[model samples]
Target: MFIFKLLVILTLGYWIMMLGDTLWARKLMRQLPASPKPGGSASTESFASAGLAQPRGTTAKELPLVSVIIAAKEEEASITETVKHLLNQTYPRFEIIAVNDRSQDGTGHKLEELRKWSQGKRQVEVPLTIIHVTTLPAGWLGKNHALYQGFLQARGQVILFTDADVLFQPHALADAVHYMKETEADHLTLTPKIVVNSFWLSAFVQYFFFALSLYIRPWRANIDSQHKHGMGVGAFNMITRQAYDRIGTHQAFAFRPDDDLQLGMRVKQAGLRQRLASGRTQLAVEWYKSLREAVQGLEKNIFSGFQYRVLPAAAGVIGQLLLFFFPFVAIFVLDGWVFWSYVLSIVLMLSVYSLLIQSLIGKIGKELLVFPATVCLLSYIVTRSVWLTLRQGGIHWRGTFYVLEQLKKMKR
Candidate 1:
C-alpha cells in the first residue's frame, strides 16, 4: 500500500514536470523570432554582400562557389534523383560531389551516369565531381570519410553535407546561401519536411519533429550557451570553409557516427555562430521506407545524441511518455476534482501541442489530425528506442554497426 501510494505520487510529480516542460517548450517556441525574409538584413552585415542574388536574367558572374557533398553507401535506389535535384539548383556557381563509399550496388555507376549527364548538358553550368571512396581511413566513420574525401577535392567557399535521400527545390541553395551570408552562421542546418508514405510513417515523423521542437529549443540552440549542447540532422547542413577549418572538419569527430551532433558541438565549442532554419520551402527528405528502418535509424542516434548517457536518455523517454500520454489517461481514469485537475493539465498541454502542430503543418502541408496520433505513436517509439539502446548498445546503419561506448568514453 505504501509502495502504491508512492508510485501514484511519483506519477503525479512526473506529470507536473511534464506539464512544466510542455509549457517551457511552448515559451521557447514563442521566443524564436519569425525568420527574416529570404534576403533581409540582420544586425551583422559584414558578409551580407556575398549573399545570393535574385534569379533574374543576368549573365552568371563569379558567385561564391558551393560544394555539395553526398556520402552514399549502396544508395543506388535514390542517388540518381538526389544528384538530379542538386544539379538542377538555381544557384549557378556550385559543384555536386557524390562520394560513393564502397557501395556494393550500382551507386558508383549511377554517379558516373550523373557525371556524364552533367558534362553533356550545355544548359547545366555548375561542375560535377564523383569521388569513389575505395577505402575508409582508420578511426573515421564511413559517411565522414566520404565527406572528407569530397572536401579534399572541393574548391568551394561553402560546403554542404546532405544525404542521398533528399530532394531539393531549385532555390534551396540560393536561399540557404543568402541566409548564411546574412546571419554569418558558421554552420547552418535546416529541418526538412519529412515525406511519409504510410500512416504509421506519418505519425512517427510528425511526432518526432514535434518532440524535437520541445527538447531542442531552436532559438537557444542557435546561439552559444552553456546549456546549448544539441544535435543536428546530417540530412542537410551547410558549413562555411572558415567554420569547417575552425571546427577541424570531420577529422575532429572521426570515430563518431553521430557526426552531425558532434559537428554542431564542435562549432559551439569554437564559439562559431550556428543557425537552424525551417526548410519547408527548400528541402524535403524521406527518412525511412518502413517502421523498422525508422526504429533502427533512431536507435543509432538516441544513445549517441545523449553522449551515451543512459540516465538522461532514459529520463527523456519517460518524460516524453508522460507528456504525450498523461492527458488521455487522465481523461479516462480520473473522477470529480481529480478529473478537473486532469482536464486542466490536458487542456494546457494540448493547447501548446496544437500551436506547434499548426505551425509545422502550415509550413509542411500535413493534415491537422495527424498531430494527435503522432503524440501517442511517438511515446511508443521513445520507449522502444530506450529499450533498444540499453539492450543493443547501438544501432546498425548501411551495413555498419555503430557501437555505443560508456558515457564517460563518448567524449573521446
Candidate 2:
C-alpha cells in the first residue's frame, strides 16, 4: 500500500514536469515560421519578408552554393524519386551528390539510370553527381562512411545531408536556406512529416516525438542564452562546409548509430550556432512500412540513445512503466485521494500529449487513444535493443556486425 502511494506521487511529479515542457515546446513551435507554400510566392520570398535580419544580398547569384549529400544503402525504392525532387529544387546554386554505399541491391544501378536521364534531359543547373563506394573501411559505420565519401566530392559552400527516402517540395531548400541565412545559423535541421499509415504506428511515432521533445529539450537550442542545447534530424541536416569541418566532420563519431544527433552535439560543443525548424509542409518521409519494421529498424539507435549503458536503458524502461502504465492500473485498483491522484496524473499526461499534437500536426485527433499502447510498445523496443546488444555481443546494421566493445569505446 505504501509503495503504491509513493508510486502515485512520483508519477504525478513526472507529469507536472512534462506539463512545463509541453508548454515551453508550444511556445517555441509558435515562434517557428512555416515553410512557404508550394508554387505560391516561394520563388520570390526573401529575408526582408520574413522580418529577419539579412546578412548580405538575397539575389540568386549571391546565395552560397548548396551541395546535397545523400548516403544510401539498399535504397533503390526511393533514390530515383529523391534525386528527381532535388532536381526540381528552386534553389539555383546547388548540387546533388548521391553516394552508393556498397549497396547490394539495385541502388547503384538506379543511380546510374538517374544520372543518364538527367544528362539526356539537360538538367545542368543542379548537376547530379554519383559516387559508388565499393567497400567500407574499418572503424566506420556504413552511412557515416558513405556521407564522408560524398563530402569529399562536394564542391559547394553549404552542404545538406539527407536520407535517400526523404521527399522534398520544390521550395524546401530555398525556404530552408533563406531561414538559415536570416538566422545566421551555422547548422540547421528541419523536422519532416512522418507518413505512417498504420494507426498504431502513427501513435508510436507521435509518442516518440513527444518523448524526444522532453528528453532533448530542442526548443532550448533556439535560445541564444542556451549554448549547450542542440538538435538534428536525418531527414534534413544542413550545415556550412566551415562548420562541418570545424566539428571534425562525420569521422568524429564514425561508429555512432545516431550520427545525425552526434553531429548536432558536436556543433554545440564547438560553440557553433544550431537551429531546428518545422518542415512538415516542405519535407516528408515514410518512416517504416509496418510496425514490425519499426521495431527492427530502431534496434540500431535506441540503445545508442542511452549511450549503450545497461543501467540507463533499464531506468528508462522502468520510468515509462511507472509513469505511463502504473497510473491507469492504479486508478481502478486503489481508492481515496490516491485514486484521484492517479486520475490527475492521467489527465496531465493527456494534456501534455494534446499540446504536442497541436504543435506538431496543428490538430488533435484519435491518436491519444493509442498513446498508452504505444508507450508499452516503445518500452519493449528499448528492452529488446538492450537485450540483443548484450546477447549477440554487437549490433547488426547495413549487413555489418559491429562489436559491442568497439561501439562503446566510440560512443559519443
* Candidate that would win on lDDT: 2
- Report the lDDT tens digits of candidate 1 across residue range 364-409: 3344355556665655666666677668776565666656553335
Q: What is the C-alpha lDDT of each candidate?
A: 0.70, 0.84
The C-alpha RMSD of each candidate to the native structure, in angstroms, is 5.3, 3.3
Q: Across residues 1-412, which tens digit of lDDT does each residue of candidate 2 receive? A: 8998898888899899989877877666632364443322444355433332324434456678899999999999999999999898766678999999989999999999999888888645578899999987999999999999999999999999999999998778877887887789999888888888888787788888877776787776666666676788888999999999999999999999999988887888888888887788889899998888998999766998998999999998998888887787888899999999999999999998788866765566688887778889889999999999999999999888999999999986
Q: Estimated TM-score per prediction?
A: 0.81, 0.93
RMSD of 2: 3.3
- Rate residue 127 of model 1 by lDDT: 83
C-alpha displacement of 117 in model 1, angstroms?
1.7
